[model samples]
Target: MSLSVARRTVTTPILLGLLLVAFALLALVVGSKPFNQTIIDIFLKVIFVVGLWVFIGNSGVISFGHTAFACLGGYIAAWTTIKPMLKGTAMPGLPDWLMGMEIPFWASAVLAAGWAALWALIFGAVLMRLSGIAASIATFAMLAMVNSIYSNWESVTAATSSVVGIPIVRSIWPYLIAALIAVFAAWAYGISRHGLALRAARDEPTAAAASGIDIPRARLIAFVISGAIMGMGGALYAHSIGIVTPDTFYLGLAFITLSMLVVGGMGSLSGAVLGVLILSSLIQILRWLEAGIEIGTTTFALPGGVQEIALGAVMILILMFRPAGIMGNRDLSLPRGAASDSQGQTGPKT
Candidate 1:
């Protein structure tokens, strides 16, 4: 590599190390209330981003429908936790085993993730056939289709109304543990053979197929894993809020997650994590702005369209400048830099 490129390679890890430390600090101290929820929120963000990274980062695909798996998980854990005997408007069709089952929080959470994987297994068959823009459109349509069901399927989920009574057990510690697991899982997938296959297909679909790789299978595997992770995340989210509604499953979430991925760097998992941290905090900042717009005595109407405007601006800027993403395809740990020659002579810029 040339001197300039060598300098960049050396500097990258140093910068990432500093940023990781900063994120850790921020996670520990983002809230003013001091209830220690900021740390938990950080963990939740980590889980959500890592889950999204598994599919979009590895396969170079966008899925606008993952919220459904999250919904699936939320309902599963909610049903498992709420008293089946009382049967408040949770899911009317909740399994007989769940009714009065009274499983532990951890178990219920695992099952919620498993159920999410199962849902992906069934749905992926239809969705994986398409790729690029077509896949994105179909997956988005799938989300709309699922949203219709969730909005109306009250007997199974109390319809559009919210359900409560889910015990709130998740806190900073639980979030920490979950985040660690998520990070490890995401890292493992990045290097695993499945990941390799997916990457191969993503970079060169025709070549990968010629080598006997099944593009759809690789995408489906990633999809199932992504859905499972989202399920766990949803269960955690539901438990955190102690209640849920159909509104939680659609609209803002998928976009927020997608924004996180793109802003951080669609090509990088570390990008996804950074994207979440940045965007989550941005929401708080926007809310703060809205508050600032309000008068001390009377409320001033906060301006509309701020978030969409901001996110769109950021996405466009990133696309223009750092097209690979904030971190490119690298991370704070385990960065895979572009190759260099034995003498470290830099090639011409691509």
Candidate 2:
């Protein structure tokens, strides 16, 4: 690659990483435990949304099942981090070796990624065969199936009950590091040959297939990579709160992450990061309002559920005005616009 092209290649991730670092510094300056936690939440959302972007942005496939991978990862954290005696009491059906295994939070996160990736490969092998709405439906079905199994497998999963005693990681640095890793990973994959082929298959399916690109194979690669990222995010999420439950990684998380992707621009990696940051900030503001702010003598507060309502309204407004999302398929690049390294485009058609 030419020097300018190489410069462009690294610029996007560097910009995104700097943004995350800025947030971490802001949280440190604020020093409020609540604000720090909110920043951590934003980092986790960044990880999840970016993970979604790796596959959906490149392949143009909307997946409702990615959170199921998160669910798997969350349980992995619960199984591996909790004390052995606690695991035996809460999940008697765990294999003896698994029940006895106790690892650190970081180790559990690594294991979670591998576990989630394995399932992604298994599901993607079949699901990637379908396209359009058929594939979307298949993914949703996969989510539902996973949810059902986890909800009922009482011995292994504790069924619908919450599993507690996870090692809570209150530090912001870990989350910041994980989010940066996620950003770089997505940026790297977007420029890879597989990513290029997947986008080709997405934009010109018949032509790409005619040229000998295996669309399913390319998509499956993205699926597994994305699944691994989501898994690690899920594991970190559990550590963030010191608990895990089947419902925690279900539809709510799936929708919120997807909304971030859509609102930021589905085709741009920069959009994914911006979506989470923007919406998460708005949510925090609404939450503060709900908790009531004291202004001189009187206290003002919005309704309890205004955050959710506001989020829905904001999404509607963005969709109406900026149908392509806030970024609109553009990466956040340096001033020189001639060399744009957007994940949405793989340079001019040769």
Candidate 3:
């Protein structure tokens, strides 16, 4: 790479790191709840949004069913930390092997993500084979399928009611570490040749195939990787909530995740993180506005839907003005000639 591109690769991450630290500290300080818990929540959100960017943002394949992966992760992870004898507290059916098979927090987490990735492999194969509206339709269908399974599969997760006593413990430190790993994983992938090929395939499938790239393989790989990451995020969220239900994943969460990616800049990792922070804060502000706060001389009176309305307006405005996203496919602003020597020049400039 040239000096300028090289500099950006080095310095841009440093700046992002600083920003993460700043935001994390801010998260740690917010609300009356323990700072650690709040920080953990934000960090998990970071993981979810950033992980989604790996596929949805880069490959330009919008998925509306990622919540399935999240739900799978949460349910499986619940099995690890939850003591089976808790009876109704654990998932029903309780296969004899799982009835007493409670593992450590992290181990269960790994298994949960593995299961999610396996599902992604199967579903992503079919979905990745499609394009544009067809692919989107398949993904939406996947979400519906996953939702039905989660809701009706009582044998495993306690039916439609609560899956209780998950024994989830949330803290700032673990999530902070997870967030760092997630960001680095996304950055490394984006900077690699495989990612380059995927992006190429996304922009022009016929040309990419003519150039010997296996478009399906690239999309599948990206899909699996992204699903696994989202699973990890779900595990974290499950542990945070201590208990959950299938309904948890179906309440507009998929839309929220997609919106975050769109608002943040579907083209770049920073945009993913930025979009989450901006939108999450917006929600908090709206909540505070709707519930009049005691501020010395004034009380704010905002409508209840202010948060939703504001987010919707912002999303519309962003899409209308810069459809590519805030970063517009630029990972980071390059300094002069950073990429002096780069591969895949034949690929369209992103």
Give lDDT per model, in order. Answer: 0.74, 0.93, 0.75
Give the local distance difference test score of model 2: 0.93
- The all-Cα superposition gives candidate 2 an RMSD in Å to the true structure of 1.4
Displacement of residue 239 (Cα, Å) in model 2 is: 0.5
| Model 3 ranges off by over 4 Å | 1-13, 27-31, 34-36, 87-90, 333-350
Q: Tens digits of per-residue lDDT for model 2 on 127-217?
A: 9999999998899999999999999999999999989989999999999999999999998888877888999999999999999999999
lDDT of residue 265 for candidate 3: 82
lDDT of 1 by residue, 1-350 (tens): 23553444444334433454465566557654433565466667678777888888888888888888888888887788888765644566776776767777778779989999998999998889889999998888888887788788777778888888888874456666666677667655655668778888888789899999999999999999988988998888888878888779787888877777888887766677788778777766676576566568877655877866877888899889988778776555333575421111112345
Worst 10 residues of 2 by lDDT: 1-10
Q: Judged by TM-score, which candidate is best?
A: 2
Q: Candidate 2 clashing pairs?
A: none
Question: TM-scores across all candidates?
Answer: 0.82, 0.97, 0.90
The positional error of residue 49 in candidate 3, measured at the CA in angstroms, is 1.5
Candidate 1: the clashing residue pairs are: 1-344, 1-345, 1-346, 2-346, 91-156, 92-155, 154-158, 154-159, 265-325
- Which numbered prediction scores highest in lDDT against the true structure? 2
Order of candidate numbers by lDDT, starting with the best: 2, 3, 1
